[model samples]
Target: MRKINYKDITNQQLIDVRTQHDYQAGHLKNSLNLNPGNFKTYATYYLDLNQPVIFIVGSEEEGHLEELSESANELGFNQKNGYLLIDEVPKEDLQTTETILAEDFLNKSDDFILLDVRHPDEITRPAPEKNLVNIPFEDLVNDYQSLDTSKQIFTLCGSGNRSTAAASFLESKGLNPKVIEGGMKAIQEIGK
Candidate 1:
């Protein structure tokens, strides 16, 4: 399988396959909004089969980006089209990250910014505690800009997948962000 990273998507066009709520909240710079399931139609209409196209979404579990690419390839979209850029957190660290966030940061909300990487709708529907910001994984690139580089930034999401990836991204940017051991769900249950 070919490997691609978010950093490799500088010049290519981006297709954000997230909800309208997630799209409006924030997304990668210059990403065209579209739902992942409906992307095939859009690909045929607007996206030239000759040019590259990068696809993004809020979460892999929510929308199978990998499967989307496979479908695209099967449909001959990749014959001369652009590559798809998908960001996913490794499964190995998911459990460890969840434990840390719940054990360390949630109770200490005052001491850190609880950066929730889940979609805005997921966090906002139940409404996170006052200090949380729903940046989502797809929007992490944009939301990270306004943050204070010097302060401690904690990353968390639904299961811990997105948050780990997000934490790595911030670390690369020199923010030195901390990943919440588990994620929001873990924090809610274990935290007071």
Candidate 2:
């Protein structure tokens, strides 16, 4: 894989390899957030193999750049252009999404909608019966349009990670999404 620069890839697809939190704080315009953990599943659904895709990785995530690139190739996207160290992109130019903690979220009654992004098998218990939408993260690519776009949505998963990614996607869809920071972990703790 080749190391590339941001200026060169403006016309190409940019996949941000940082965590959802880092991505929400700042990220390149039109770049997709596909952290390596969800790279396989997420990319499989959203990526267009024909269009060249470049990865943008932070120092902490640089180690997985090659792994993601390889996975992209294996998934039939051989045109993976290269990668960009996130440091090269100006922080002021990055975009962001919002996030809220479980504790704070629970206090709100009907102000927001809850989108549980966890897999069905991982759901050992039921989500809150009200104001909740259960759509697994992988299914979001297909089911996103089914979501209620009138209200702010809080994306929840096992940890804050996937929700952040989910929220990023929702944000891209012209919907308002806030990640449930700490995800189900925070909700579980609050329940105890």
Task: Please report the candidate that would top lDDT against the real structure.
Answer: 2
**Cα lDDT tens digits for candidate 2, 1-192:** 789976776577778889877888898766778889888978877778888888888899888877887888888986757888888888787877877878889888776678998888999756665688889888998999997688788888887877887877777777768888888878888999
* Candidate 2, residue 43: lDDT: 86
**All candidates: TM-score:** 0.48, 0.92
Off by over 4 Å in 2: none
Local distance difference test, per candidate?
A: 0.56, 0.81
- Strongest candidate by TM-score: 2
* Per-candidate count of clashing residue pairs (backbone under 3 Å): 11, 0
